[model samples]
Target: MHKEGDEIHIDEQEASGGSKEGVVRWVLAGGLILAVLLMSIVWIIPAMTQGDIEEEATVSGEISSMEGGDSTDSIVGIDGEPGDGGEVTQEDGIEVIEN
Candidate 1:
């Protein structure tokens, strides 16, 4: 009867010990997830935002002029006359049509 009591006491101790380790593991996992989220917001989000701005700047720079020369005069529309719908005309020796 004493041996049976001792075994039950040991089992109770083991159960408590296992529960403590489980709680510690859960806390550590929660802490790691929090750290990752914080790092992403602080570092990754800003970098992504900055990347979009940089891409826009690059696109604007590319559109400023074509490869060989200044292309401002070579381009038309918006600055030129608004076209009559579906009308064909000749301008700058190029056929202009609005469809």
Candidate 2:
């Protein structure tokens, strides 16, 4: 079997250069899509947290507002015999002093 000179010699550039333009376009499009998605997430998280979203338009994994998050004062302290590891007795109430 005899092959022509051009057929026998395949340039290295031919192996990868043919699709360079297409690949670049795809990468740019992907970057644009990613930027848009990031912006939307940033905008949406605060909007949802601030109760800007209606009850029907709520998305999954949305952040809740912090209006009542400071109500952690209702958390009961560990009631036990006073000792190491912050153990407490019933007479000695545990008061969390948060300044």
Best by TM-score: 1
Poorest 10 consecutive residues by lDDT, candidate 2: 75-84
What would the TM-scores of all predictions be?
0.34, 0.33
Regions of candidate 1 where Cα sits further than 4 Å from its true position: 4-9, 12-21, 48-99
- Tens-place lDDT digits, model 2, residues 43-94: 9897767644564255442334334365454434343334423443344575
Clashing pairs in 2: 80-88
lDDT by residue for model 1 over 10-76, one digit each (tens)? 5555656645447888999999999999988898776566754464476564564346474565544
lDDT of 2 at 10: 56
lDDT of each: 0.63, 0.58
Report the lDDT of model 2 for residue 92: 53
